[model samples]
Target chain A: MKEEKNIHTNSEVLVKVEGLSKKFCKDLKTSLWYGVKDLTANVFGNKNVRQLRDKEFWAVKDINFELRRGECLGLIGHNGAGKSTLLKILNGLINPDEGKVTIRGRVGALIELGAGFNPILSGRENIYNNGAVLGFSKKEIDEKVEAIIDFSEIREFIDMPVQNYSSGMKVRLGFAVAAQMEPDVLIIDEVLAVGDIGFAMKSFNAISQILKTSAVIFVSHSMPFISRICDNIILMDKGKMLLKTNDVGFGVQSYFDNQKLLGALNFGEENIILNNVKIHSENPRLEGIIEYGKKSIFEINIDSLNDYPKVKVSILVYNMAQINVALFESRYISIKSIKGQKFIFDFGDSFLSISNYFITVRFDDLDNKKALVVSNYVNYRSFQVTGAERLVFAPLYLKEKI
Target chain B: MPLETRIYQKENHLKLGHLFKASFKDMLSSRFLAKQLAVRDIKAQYRQSFFGILWAFITPMFTALVWVFLSRSGTVTLTETGAPYPVFAFTGTLIWSIITESINAPTASTKSAKGIMSKINFPKEALVLSGVYKLLFNTCIKTLLLLFFVFFYGVGFHVSQLFFPLAILMAILFGTTIGLFLTPIGMLYNDVGKIISVGLSFLMYVTPVVYVIPKEGLMKTIMELNPLTPLILTSRDLILGNPPAFLNYFLILFAVSALLFSVALVFYRISIPILVERSNA
Candidate 1:
């Protein structure tokens, strides 16, 4: 009977799940009348799918987990912190008003990667229509269609028509046919946050060669690709699992210590005001974060509503995909009729690497040498940096001895 | 390594014999993703047409030439259709446009595969079997224009007209069993696909496709309680050859439309994961 159910059992759990949940409604006509009363109480059986009716909610709660054959879990949160509804209920694509998932062999989902592309066909016929919707088999997409047209380098526009290619050559031929879907468990949403960077390091090395014999889960916000191929993690927020771990760097440092610190200070056209914006960090841990190449300072205080022999402030910073890595400025710190004045700056050994950052500041008017008027603010302040050693890709680790 | 577990609960603990044996084993492993999504939707449906595949023989020869020019200018009065009213109204609107394109092929092939079923988890019975393989490739070009209108209207051939592809596969299995029981409320309401194309054009003016079933009053008792009047009068009497005037009411409406097409494929596999979790984004 199919070779007694093909019994090759090495580390075998494959994926378990359990206490999972789903809910969700936030009104689309009362979530389509609670999806036609939970699909007529689940097609006439009517077990009443455990509570919470009107205005629903729990977009995946109680989500327990498991994964064996070469484990990898990770699912960190924020962005409706349900982590793509628990990877669409572990890729069965929905249905978990309560719990229990199971799964075993075949699951593959690096989501929407050319999901059945056919922009008038032809990228070698959408690689056999996205390799027969990722289940493969037209003689295994004709023996992996010449390595998916040589890892989607376009191969002279693989016979033309995918609506004339370019959109980074249709996301590098949809990540080379979802990296030739081998599938044992694999899930991976945020399909490597979309292309470009040598095809995201050749699809992160074809998803680390299909994560060395499957059993993944992933979902990300890229806490360094979830601390590089996660061993286990969870985090999630609004819909439960505040933290689950197998350490993966303290579950990605408690998902950046449950991030919320935006540190508001807007006063746009209020000219110049703020009285204290600190950020000292000699080696501050969690709460203030900053440790990597330690020495920091950012004082500020300020008041100057009018006089100015010179001013020029600037700051900038950013990162956390906000990009603008670093910049400083200052030089003319007179603020003539200065009030609370403070000023500081320093930031000695701050090479910037670990992560979280913000800061926009700006105050000018160096006697209008066209440095015109003053005060600006936007995303005013925020901070976090912690290291010890982990700079695989570097946003800024410049120790510069070379 | 085909361990094959796949549990996923909450459908009242499933087990209707494992949901009809996993919906007939994912409709037999979605036959090569329903023939590669019906050859990538029949080659992107005629690669942006320009008379490509002659627009499926010019849409049922232009709705049978506007009902053969409104019953030859009588403006709509019609009766006595033994065969030859423009080849019996172009084989009754080419078998009523293959039973209204098999009742709009399982909700227009699951709404043009709603962006690949909300980010892939295949075997959605390959989008209603790739809409019955693009309604049998536009019913093989409306069966070669109903064999060139039964030999250009002379209406000769007979071996029971070789059962006209089994009466066009019993009008696409009884219009895909009431379009798979109106595709779980037409994939959750667009008013059940605009009330099934305005109730199949007012149900093609009460059945008999383009007039014929009337032999008495009350429009022949509403065309004998219209179950598509024995599948368009046995596919226009096996395409004008004859001997099939409701052959036992077309074998009891093809055994009650093959038992309502296996109860509309087990109510389309228990309402497609609750209509894919309320039509996911």
Candidate 2:
């Protein structure tokens, strides 16, 4: 294997894409009709596939990139941003309309785990079936069967019918086989987001090891994973490349900055309406920003038509990934005959990393079991913590004197 | 040791000269995967069933028995078929069933593997080869029962029986040729599959299955004109040790089907990616 790697030098370009594009129809009926027409054109050797017909739009447009051996390219974009379409074309599952994609050596895609597995068959039997589909000969699979079983950590259930196995077990087995495939060009989608944390970490480590040899194309929404593995990054949106740079951090930062903010959402009983949410800071320059070690006060205004005996208010803050980071709850407060009421909480010098965060306010019963009214100020009242960007493994930067 | 490079472009896909070479290479490479898939399907098909593989034999036998009962009860009158009527009906039904299975194989196999195709990039030819593998497995079982029926009816074995395998291969090839041509379209529109079964039941009547060819009439002319007639008659004649009346037609059909089968292979190669994109929807 080492000698083989030396043969295909690290600088050898394994994948090249030039002006690649594909058009897809939105309507099913029209798509089928176009399929018939495209097939006819293909049969007749017609070269008119580049033009988009009625009801068709470009799914991937004029995308170009090159990847060489031992280089990993990260593809970051929001959903429906043509990242998946680009990966499909690179994997050779579909054809491009305008340009060409030249890929050398064997290519493997981790698009979906356990894709070819038959549930009725035993896990052991499916390993062989899946291996064969991955282009492994019988003897080759025979040699790696034990290693795959060990890697999956389901040796005891190897002979058990896969239908009876848990979903996590199937994913483990699938990842095990894929990890062992030493393809020259590896296309990794978001398949790492499966199984439990332990298995996911194991697969991630295995993939990072494989990255040393193969020219990899990785697509994921997790910025940390992308920054950790990708030597370079390409940010895409609306079927076009937004940024192509060696600075993984800048690319990821741009991706976060490009996320569209959500509007204010206040939904519940019509009688209790959320009026406004405002933040007050001591420094006018940091009015909307929350610094790592600064005091900020958040005020919530509500108009209640009917008086409530007792209500509890809870404020939850979530990061850009929608992960809950902070929660502040107020004890029971009686509100009677108050048309306009206010609740205020002071956030004092909390150490939060520089990123965008949203707040969700919920008014629940005194017991905190039932919600009376809820208001989500996702992007409408979102706040950003400003600081010099630094590379850290954890989501939050917690500082303590040492 | 240079790596094997594959280039994908719309125009490159239309290169008819390279399509056959690539399809054949993929077919050869996918043979092992095809066998594995076929074995998995065959095992899973009968794994949990009560009767297991007995159903494969029971199905054709039951159909053959129904026709035999109809013939014996005077519900349908039939002309003399040289050998015993039960043997004649059973063999005819067996051959007809093989043909139908082959016709349905490509689409059926591709549909079953739709889950994998959209997710993984593999040699698409594997699905077609796997379908053929499954068809051959089922055919083997049916042929065993067919031989038993032929001998039990006392249509004593003859040297001409040596040609049975070749005759059967020709039948499968003919059926598969038609099937391969329809698979690309069939994967896109299920109407092709539904229409095929309906058309096949009607077509069986005109192909001399479960009945002898008419002695002299318009029915005979239709039977003679049917492409399947030569395949069925030649296979039955070879197995039953009768001088094949349609040997020349069978040979000609074989040559034509072989040529068409190659064309269909290339067409499938060209049309599959487009069909796959639609089916993924």
Candidate 3:
């Protein structure tokens, strides 16, 4: 089945990482001492190698993947899931403790915006400096300088010191330089969220232009953006790979499901508590797929020890990346009597896209200031927007008159 | 697509020749970047200062003036330097400053770029090369000042003076060799930079910078033992039309400097990444 699904007949692998791992020490003094010891061991003919020592742990381990030309790989993980560490290792900013990474062709990275820019230098000068740091020749920068400045939209401020440029301008210029370099492999780490929406669109268009020829590895918390750009996805957790698949929808669903199992939600200490939460459709037999433009109901069961004066219930719908997509709240109809009551949220028509989503149930006071019970259930249920046109740029399908 | 890059843990067995060749090529490819960095530093070094580039010559010139005043006041007895006291002291201090500045340049440059180094991957040799460029610029300014001092003191020019630039170059190479060796350590610990600053000032007195080396004494023996003593003496001899003294010692030291610099480059290539990672961690 896997062989049959292999689509690219002439694609070549641009980046191959095999069993790569990196260990980091928690304590500064111990880390420095470990560095010295490692250096000495390298200098000497000592072959003894241990994976971990005191105060040290693997930040990334046994990560294996191959990126091919014209492919965009999405790296989805929660914070501290070793995504940044993996990017650093691939970019050659840091060394790995074990395994090997073989890369073909030049690698351009927007790892951090304006990372190598000298604040005292003018924007024009920093363009040259940044290009050089990215391994561009002076003649190459000279040829592309005008286009870079034009793309950044900071032509007027090009002669001003970079310290004077705003943060948005800095990112614009940074992305321009990296994009113009035409690297064979491009690695972007959540740098697209910078600038206003217009600039973000422009930058994404530039990325798409580059995607035609170069392999890309991008990490973003925006699921919509990921689905729009990525052809393959890898889900990571606590320095380990959990899933790697080409189906963007399934990969996003798996990521949310894993987050639900691992993330510990902080519940409020109050008289009322959530007993259970379930999603139901019109057809009781149907499971795991909610067809678009159909009715769906969220049933939340509450268990209370005593009656309360005023109580409100709310259900928040979140995308896999934990971004809130919709909210269902019982604000107008208050629960004066807090007996074990079931709150049913009915949506006339569901417009959610084909992806995983989270349901967070919360019982709050009358003013919504105090939470009686807070339960964050990630990937509580997943639905597919079947028989509808796929919306890759956004999860919500709003009816418009345009 | 013609090149394949593989990264892994460094091996225990050192390939000295391969390391040298690779590092040399990397440094050569990064020359334009190094030039940009150097240009940034040179422009920023004096941008906000009122004295601007004058500060480069003022400090050493003031030191020379103090020594000349003391010598004329007869408060401190001094051995006869072959040239006029002011010219001798000025030239000596100027060369000594070049040594000290070159030694400090690499460490300072690398430290300042620590933020960028940890965040970005580039040919780090560019930083060292940029520091060298700054040293060359400063040395050129100081050389012009030295010419002024020679004319002001009415010291006649000699054909041998043509080799003065070579002497200065040697001093810079010697200092930069030591500096490159210390850069990794200096970047790791703040104390290394502080100690160098204080130690270089104290070391000046032990070298024959202002006065001639005594014929026989503890200070003379210490001065003779100092490696910089021969370098400074040879540079001064070359500029003053005297057959350079300690030519054999200078030759030996030059060879040692080259070897140490090569070794330091290897060590630097290996250690800098670790140091940068540690700092970020």
Candidate 4:
């Protein structure tokens, strides 16, 4: 694993954004009027006032970052948190209202796949069109057309119009073109979530191949992806940076903590509300960091409205995608639990992937065949599992003897 | 290759010359993309239509036929137009269509690419250049029709007729310049496009497209004052082997169009991103 340190101090900076901010109007009419006014003001030599006007709010504010070569910066945030806006500004699709961004290379952006494709044009023709839109010349496209078709694996349908191609095929072709461009700076936003798992893997391989040389900025809500690819992560909330860290696990944890603090509503009935949830290492003195190969305990406290018998508490550990990694049932603990109790689930070893996991505690009444309460069902409490290995995708680690 | 680029907020001072040079370089480098876009538009235009490219000829021919009917039926009396009625009307409306097309091309091109522009980052100049390409394609088709009418009217070719292409180029320059200036405004408001459409149709009447200008009347004064009148008149004179009239006015307009186009390019480079940003918002 590469040492997690500030690479900016030693490497050549490829992208530098300073004091960047953008404001957007809520209403279309007002936006248009403001555009005209700004244009007129600019033409007449009026200094651009950086303050917000009526009905305008900052979409991104006071962002500063420097990305060096061979380092990928992951931008994570909730929807409408200005991630896309920042990407747009970096791609030169829009200008910031208050700062400057200097990019020192050709930027190949897969912001939206197949953005300029003409539905009436054949796939072969659209390769030229879409490639040109990405700054490739006609002769260059002519030289690389075969490789693009081969990479997309859609050579059989290259002569057919794009309108006839299925959605997955379109994504394949789009990503193939973008991946082959060999840009010095790559800005990709949630495009890897497209296509089937096979194509996604192929795209990931392509990205990693590019990461060997280019400086990349990736925006995705997938924690596993960010943990896998990004050396530095910026956790953003409401258009402001909350934390920037070199530790991927810590960054993902900070993002989840911020999300929890933002009051993401819990869905379970208040009959058994979660009183407290805490994670600690096996050693009582050391807390917070969960290291791999060490026993850890998850303590969940629930407050019950009334005393109830035959209550079973189940602790479920889920990966970032909410897929269950492991489930621990109270039956294994040999505890006769009732309402209003603290349940401690202990694992022998933390063999889970080096990623974020969410714990969901479910309180069920066995006699009545009903769920009495669930703890943080809507927004589960997430914890990070850090390990020595940097590349781990699946939830569980297993060893097999040949 | 590492191509350095910068993004910044609106500042009080801008190096206009540097900005213009950079924008021109960007446009020139993206010429292949512009050509590809033009090819895409031209191919898609007639793909689903029953009439296809024939509509291009049918529109002006149909317009000329209607005006000829009105003249023959004595519904609208026209002044002496030395050439045969069909030939004169055809040539007039053909030139008029070319000008209107040139004026409409920029807005239409930019508007059609609005979806992609908001999502992808590319040189917006490519759209303008592609619009010019489409205009050229249409002009080629119209020029062929004009030659057919010229011979049909017994107006044989003369050495002066060699300058007809120059006149057509001037008309395009004039219309495209005005269109470029209107593009940003048009992208912001749908009403601009509608207004331009309505205004161009009405403007043709005062430009002497199908009728001679009145000798002495308020209409003549307005016709004489129209900047387009000199353009259409000089072009028509050249095509008919007559000494080009209003050459000075046309030359002045030509120079103004060039200057306006440069300004328009700068305006487009600055405003288009803002417009796209707002639209995305």
Candidate 5:
């Protein structure tokens, strides 16, 4: 056999997003004027582009990645890591503030379930509209209409208006349209967590069928799904990337590592003012911080930002719905003295049996009720927890036969 | 651990023109979507009601009566063929209802469908266009009621009255223009939708829809300046053949439509992507 050449072709990459960032801002002058002067400035100087301020909060910041033709790229990161921002850029639903993204074919992004569907219209009508949105023609949508309905398993209500359908049915129908249309690139956010287990299973299997030719950029906290299908993983945090790799297991572990680190470091205020913070976990995902039913460690470091302080640097456990479930305020619980700007909080010995949770740390200057209970003046990191926690935020005790 | 180094990469968007065209193309191809939207629009009001579609025309009919009673003292002056004041009032009311529905169509037609813009991949214009089809349905039914007045009320009309279609077309053109002009701005500025609706309501009386033609200088000029005024007066003129001096405003509205629509298109195209990426609060 002839020696192989080491050249990579353009066709190899289905997508190239370089320095992709998107920023949304308010017109400061208009915001300031609040009257006619601001209106004039908005109309005349809006396009000046130079007079624009950098007070921008970048939703997706400096994101760079490429997806090959058939690989599923898992975008795993804690909340606010800009995963949704990156997915929007790749899907062409929106543009970025500062990067270039190139894709070879039709891209279907289900950023959220039921996003492009008209609820007042019938399920059948929405399917056609969604198909068109996914880049299919009327004939094409027509051809796939039956298949789409069958896949969603909602044929009985196909003629009924979507507004009347339940949430799960809506998601199922939405996913079916996105899948049946056969887009070159498919971007799915955390919607897989929605629907019942059977439906989730159905969605994953359907997604698998599409993965044969489609280059997928899936942003989900579900490690099993990532490991099962993603050819590579892109781990991100706080609007930046943590790592990228084909080793799915390693990626999952890394996700947990930072998660644990962030939660442990930032979950609670070690002091009145929080400063230097971090989180880590043995599972690489550091998932133990938030996900239920997993044993994990949380490490926190704190410093005083503004001094009149009595605070706790500890872990605050929140369920996925953002409800605070429990908290380990380490400062009042443990530390007796302060030496410098650093304090650490350990979750002691606990395997968070809950399936899903997030870590949030605050330095409250007051009590739990409102009179001036300031959660310090800073926000910390969060991570995920995994293992035997087979569901979302379900705290349970497992029996092992080993 | 230190913060993960987020390497900056530039995201590339296809040219604005290309995306805009693509979005519009996406909207145009979905006949089924448009039909369904039109049906839904018409059905939403009358859905599950025992009166069914009759309520669509009845509500407007009663509203016209209240306005007529409030405006006139039962004068039989509206009689084109000795028809009663109520019949003449109904004619103006029917036309006004159609125009109101059409103008209101643009504002709500697309605005209500914001859910789809963020979730699906389809061009958003289909939603905007959906309103037009729905309004057209309402207009058709109301016009049928207008014809009912023509036949049963025994109103007299010259063949020149055929120009009413032209007048109605003009009303539609202006309504659609307003919709196209304001839809994007409404999305950008939270209050734009409310402002457009209110402004249109004020302009309705300024047009001859709710009142008679005014006599004077800048007031006439201002009255003439209102786009729908010309269409309304011209329809009455079709029955009488001496089109109002406001006829010049037709050309002006045509120009305004182009300008407003083009500006709307540009703004919509520019703001779309940014609007889509906002979190689902």
Candidate 6:
């Protein structure tokens, strides 16, 4: 019987979603009672009827993805990108209107910290409640209870109501419950951003340890975290998956760049979306590593604009090599601020040591703080000094360095 | 992929027995919360009134008193056989009112419990089911009051009246069916309450709650179509020792209950996904 059913199932892959769609119903439908009156021609026009006139909200459309075992897939998206909804569907919290989410393993999700937890209940009470909600039996909860409590480090207050607990405590308990649940598949939905930095580090460490045994799906805005943790990144926007990438910085930059590329902005002629950014201005032969005290100038040419836009321009240079550096100050003078305007500043023998540097261009007037044009990356232009670099921001320069 | 699709089918089409058991467990665990909510509903209904829950008894008593006055004035005849006219009207109205409240419950509870659903990932049916639970509690209270009157007013019960609960079940079954079908529509439609309001009360009177039975064919057809008629009559039969059509009420109630539950499960499954997705997580 199972084989017969499988034969009927179109097995393209394990999980095949051809064209997923979701529509949201409004809270107070205008077709409410007011519509009845209006349809009967009692009033001029029914506000309720007008509101109910046409309220069909589509949240997700044509969403498609496939996941296999041992894949640490990262979902990077902006707010309301439907990542959490997708996760919730995967976790069996709710059923989608027009989509299919297929999974083989016992999927586990930390979609939000303490998603079903009750504030009035004590931590101990919540453990059982939450565990039960997650589909664990009472006996299973009893067995994992000790490890969960110990990991959360809320033993002292475990018996106290969660309303009395701090935010950190909530996340801790939530994380501990998930960690101890030992699911085959784990999903983290930006909840890791909570808690202290140290605790975050500890949580990620625990996550990494768990990754050895399970597949992980993570949603985050932290690019570096995605880069370091996930094997591949899937970028989503609105309800669509825009790009899938293996490179960390490139993927992060692409996500930001895609927004500008695909945003509902009417691009005038002479306006460029800045498709590809590269800084390859070869100078007096800098070697593999630019050492300390070697004078270097970063020459950068930004390629953008369909047609040269008429506007003045300035570039903000940044040192991105994890070196102690000040905020970048805009120090370029461009007569034209229009599109396709390129301006470069030669930091001739600047007081900066060997490090990777980038420059970003932002266009805006002072009035409304509106940033008309912004690039995720400055320029790929990087320079290094060709000598021994001991001190950072060097020019602890000794006069008589024999 | 098809198997996966089957597995991902919406709103867990749990077997009926399993669903009932799970809901039962949830209600049991949440009994304290249910009590708290029912108390709030009951108290809120009569808040700041001198006669509070006594009002539950008061409404039926006044209705009966009006009937008495009408009879004394020779305005109308109650046409009672086994009991006094006032006692007859009082018992029927009291039972029917509670049952009607039960039918109207799922709608009201769905509207009121939006606060809970929006904030928590609870079983949404809890709100709907709790309404029936509250009605059950209310029904018990009303039944006890009726029993007191039956004894005090010297109305006797036959040995066959042991099946009063079976009659109550018919009422509940019909009530739950109607409640389940309308609650989600109520959640979706803003004016559902008003529609149910004027419509259901008219339905109550037509179902033979407060008057003598008319023997016209049209009246019988209307009575047959009322859905609550069998419930009221069967319950009256159990009390008054009429040859109760127990099997007929059982089949009708059972079939209607199944239909309502199935419809409710479908609506719940369809809406729950959208509800969660649209929530401000």
TM-score of every prediction relative to native:
0.36, 0.87, 0.83, 0.83, 0.69, 0.61
Full ranking by DockQ: 2, 4, 3, 1, 5, 6
- As a TM-score, model 5 comes out at 0.69
TM-score of chain B as predicted in candidate 2? 0.97
Root-mean-square deviation of Cα positions for candidate 5 versus the true structure, in angstroms: 11.3
Provide the lowest-lDDT 10-residue window in model 6 chain A.
Answer: A43-52
Clashing pairs in 4: none
How displaced is residue A19 in candidate 1, in Å?
9.2
lDDT of 5 at A258: 73
Using TM-score, rank the candidates from best to worst: 2, 3, 4, 5, 6, 1
Report the lDDT tens digits of candidate 4 across residue range B204-275. 878889898899999999998899888888878887877877889889989999888888888887887777
Residue-level lDDT of model 1, residues A226-266, one tens digit each, is: 77777888889888998888877666656654756533345
Worst 10-residue lDDT window, candidate 5 chain B:
B1-10
Better of 1 and 6 by DockQ: 1
lDDT of 4 by residue, A1-402 (tens): 123322224377889999888899999899999988877766665565678899999999889999987889999988888999999898888878888888876788878887789888899988988998888887888888998999899999999989999999999999888877676688989998778999999999988988877789999877678878998888888888878888776787777777755343355554666666676667644444567755667676666675556665566776654466866555422223245567676655566666777666666655457655533443456767775754445434222111
User: Tens-digit lDDT track for model 6 on A101-210?
Assistant: 66654566666556556666678877775665455666778888998999888899998878889989998998877766554567777766658887788788888876
At residue A281, give the lDDT of candidate 4: 66
TM-score of each candidate's B chain against the true B chain = 0.37, 0.97, 0.94, 0.93, 0.77, 0.79
Interface quality of candidate 2 as DockQ: 0.78
Question: Which lDDT tens digits does candidate 3 get at residues A1-402?
Answer: 123223434388889999888888999888878877766565453355556899988888889999988899999888889998888888887777777777877788877767678787899988988888888899999999999999999999999999888989999999888778676788989988779999899988988887877789999866768888998999998888989999887788777666654343436654555555656567745644566657666666666665555665666677655567877665433443365677666655676765556666666664445654533432344444454745545424222111
> Residue A87 lDDT in model 6?
65
Best model number under lDDT? 2
* Chain A accuracy as TM-score for every candidate: 0.32, 0.75, 0.72, 0.71, 0.59, 0.58
* Candidate of highest TM-score: 2
- When summed lDDT is taken over every stretch of 10 residues in candidate 1 chain A, the lowest stretch is A393-402
Looking only at chain B, model 6 earns a TM-score of 0.79
| Most accurate candidate by DockQ | 2
Per-model root-mean-square deviation over C-alphas: 22.2, 5.2, 6.9, 7.3, 11.3, 11.5
Q: In candidate 3, which residue ranges exceed 4 Å CA deviation?
A: A1-10, A45-47, A261-355, A359-402, B10-14, B73-75
Residue A169 Cα positional deviation in candidate 6, in Å, after optimal superposition: 4.8
